[model samples]
Target: MRFSSTVAFPLAANLLPPLASAIRISPAPNGALLLRDSYDYIVVGAGIGGLVVANRLTEDPSVSVLVIEAGDLDDRGEDVSIPGSVGFEDPRRYEVKLTMTEQEFLDNKTRTVSQGKAVGGGTIVNGLVWTRGSTANFDAWERLGNPGWGWSGLLPYFRKSETYSTRDHDISACKIPVPVHPVNGKHGDQGPVEVGYPNYYYNQSDNFLDGVQQLGIPVNEDPNSGNATGATVVPSSMTQKNQSRSDARTAYLDPALGRDNLHLVTNHTVTHILHNSSGNAIASRDTPIVNVTGVEFASNVTGTMMNVTCDKEVILAAGAILSPVLLQISGIGPAQHLKDLGVNVAVDLPGVGSNFQDHPTLQPVYKYTAPDVFSVQDIVGATRDAVREEYLANRTGPWTTPMVNAVAFPALSWVTDNFRELLDEAVNTTSNLPSSYDSTLRAGYAAQKNETLCFLSRTDTPTYELMSTSWGQLAVSAMQPFSRGTVLARSSSIFDNTQPIVDPRYCSNSIDCKLLLLGIKFNDHLIATSPMAALMPVPPPGFGTADARNETSLDETMRAMITTGFHFSGTTSMLPQNLGGVVDPSLRVYGTANLRVVDAGVIPLLPGAHTQATVYAIAEKAADIIKAGSSDAFPGAKS
Candidate 1:
């Protein structure tokens, strides 16, 4: 049942024409030749989701898969391949900066949201911490109309995505009650993505987990099995032999690249999904779903417009922001918005770009006055040079691990005293919107609010992620935020560098601010604990002081610390269309046939843990649905 191997299925590719798949990187209009005139599937955006889906769909020789990546294939240089070079490299090489200016909230401050723009997507530039959310986090997906999307349903695919390596974790090194949890499901024997521990983690990482235990919060040893609610030593998506980052580049795309049935075009921006109601295999005959014909793209550098057709489907894996932007510009969005852009509306679907959700993070820096354990704070000058030399010579050392090692997930009851009070306000976050808010969106939020209430009432739910990263910083992101934002196209020209109006609307809801303030409160308690106080001796300036840091002072620090966690989702939600969802349980867009979204965008709710692991699983399951030829593979998907 596992299909991660690169060996294509032995089937006749009679439907696919002869292709010159050996395409060298070239300038346009010559680059258009890299793409065949037609393909069975044209996948937009080569992010983690796109890469996984493309790899699986092409396993059948009868299918021709074309992956159009807006960013070029990574050089696989140490800057990207090494785990420690995360913040050191120029991000523009791997990420796109979607600038948001003068927000309606957060005192009218501006922020820039960055997403993976390369062939491997964010996995190339992201923190290599490998973790999954609670079982309840995914079970909520099933409750939200997606049946086969719960924890039990997706665990097999989660197992199908990685090969985990055993580690002799030094329990003595960790001055804690529990050392390690048993790996549940005993999964990970056959997958391309490598999941293992770093050889050169900071000595204080174990102590951080010990501090959480001292705080009365249970440390979850292996939440990857199911429930995730405590602090644990986070593993990395790193190679077992070299300890280099094992991202979408090294894992899925590279091994599958040599196959003749698969073709990938880089540095081309997909502008629109071309359609005229002609070809669609999965469009329901009873509905008014329009047939998706092809995609219109342009060279990122030369702006040479080109088009290619697809025989079956046009899959949108362009992440939360651009995927919806592509739909709106392609006339498959809100009728009024499309009319404003002077584009004819393909589908009058109003939920194309609404319900934008993200893990809004607030990072407050604390000076490590404790005996210089040589963490990210002191990775400079001679130490940096010495580590670089050791890594280059021996291929192991401080360079093998990113600054983010162990993260603590705490429930609201453990972090704050006003759990009941906060839960009441949290449940109403998505309700009672202004007149401008769509009625269907309001209904969707109402349903989502019920899920939020469910998470808050449970002891297994970790409402906040207390993470310590580089430069003596304590960052916290609300595991499940209630605020809803938008990603509307300013104009119908994303291919020409028209930045979509990107706004997560951080702190638009009152509960979101409360969650962040509670995080600040938790940081104060964390550093005060005996074990953590030894590692992070100093807290942020005068802050983290119970009485010294009141509402106004903490609010000021929060305003300065708040930033997007980069785990964006819910723009193309997978809920019933009546509930203001863009995609159904089948992941197909509301009014478009053969146009499915398989990125974090379709995840209606943000999981309590990092999105990296869950996104891979999403793509894995998505490939199954596509291979089964629609929702027929999924029970109860007939809805």
Candidate 2:
């Protein structure tokens, strides 16, 4: 079946109601204008975190907030708004290219790391999963010296940004059966963001859930509930009836367009945060005075430089990958690395770009007996036409299906236990530090020691702290890895075409590798299980073996297939200044008083679920913290 590539449709050109008056952009005199000449707050990157922060902070009419985005806003064109038409939309049409770097990972040379460079950031390009970190995961944060970050503390904000679709009770019941805990707060009825199950569903999803259950995994009606350790059909971060993608723009920017206090600038690349030399005392301190004087950026649209001063604060919400790079570019990373790139160090915070983490995933494809599963051929043929017909006529069909509608979470007890033991042994072996060593040898030793220690420390850590199991395998990840990686400057000149260093340093720790191995094994087991058995061609050909345990030798092949789960986190981590953290609990950067990082980068640790809901909750709580002069009310605030 071939789908039609062209279909005429009506568009609501006036979807966005005009504000009191449209703010026209005057051409730059010669270069772009800096924040010093513009607004009170400047938010860099328009991802979920940035949008939320920008939306909330701009609520005060007295304070004008400027959001500089690297990408263009969604056109709400047919391809972007129609379900299943995502592929038809040119990926480049929605992309704003950031520079790329040639880096090695797991022996693979030259990997390109791309980030969403457009108005909505990654939210526009992502799969739109709406999972939140577990309650246990949040509570663990409080235990880890960051108070007020637990599930109870963050529930209000979760509810605040969500307007869940109450329409499709039947579909919602089957997909997400778990009832919301009243104590956790109800879904926000008046929130700007919309959350609900996709407007359509495929039969295979239900069968997939049943297959995992047959393999001894329990079926979880709600993956968002604190416990995400079983097979479940989860909800997408999308609106219901219209099937329009619920990106950051749809959720935050659309509603905020008419607000007088909010200003969004597209095609602007923030270069650095301007500091006030007059306030040397605050500037020298670890907790930098939050008083950010200005921000400098390059106007991508005009090829000119600009500076904008902030009267209140400068917030960096550039996602896990770019946020750290932005900091390094601004001279806030390790002094040595900054000097190597010939960039002056504004702050000597070693942890500024450290602790990079993401849920690395691998796709093990199977040939199902059923004919309905989508493939590249189906996307181009008659099947596509039928699906498109149904979609345009009734708003139902394959267009509504996410890449994976149902997911399984399996606990591999054996792998978990072995990993714990291995980590413990490694830790015990490296307990005492050496007094001295050759510089070269010392560097090698330091790298090895860091990896081993992170693994060991992570294993012994409580389940809530880690999330997921230490088992032999788990198909799904709720694993909160403790290993830290770094992001540094690759070059001094942005115009010189230098790519920012993005070392996810994935599985640098042996324990992380082991956990990922277990995850694959679990995936194999679930596929082999009876209920799901019909969907599989055993061994999954190249990716797996008949004997899951013996297939451990295929670790290299598995790693090659692994890509990010889109859960990038922990860069610009929030810890006390003395502990090498960039931000305090108040989400304020060290040595900068009025500047704060209110996004996932401020997340000190990875949570056990998708970051969307948690990011929202964090923004909600941050709004309150920023509103109240005292930071003590929030988690991770310094005493």
Model 1, 371-470: lDDT tens digits are: 6566754667788778877776766777777768777888889887789988877765544343445788888888887898888778787888877654
Error of 1 at 604 (Å): 0.9
What global local distance difference test value does model 2 have?
A: 0.59
Where does candidate 2 stray beyond 4 Å? Answer: 1-36, 86-89, 96-105, 166-186, 278-291, 370-379, 412-478, 496-498, 536-540, 547-552, 635-639
TM-scores for all predictions: 0.91, 0.82
Off by over 4 Å in 1: 1-34, 169-178, 277-286, 428-436, 496-498, 541-549, 635-639
Q: Write the residue-wise lDDT of candidate 2 on 30-63 in tens digits.
A: 5444233668778877787788878777778887
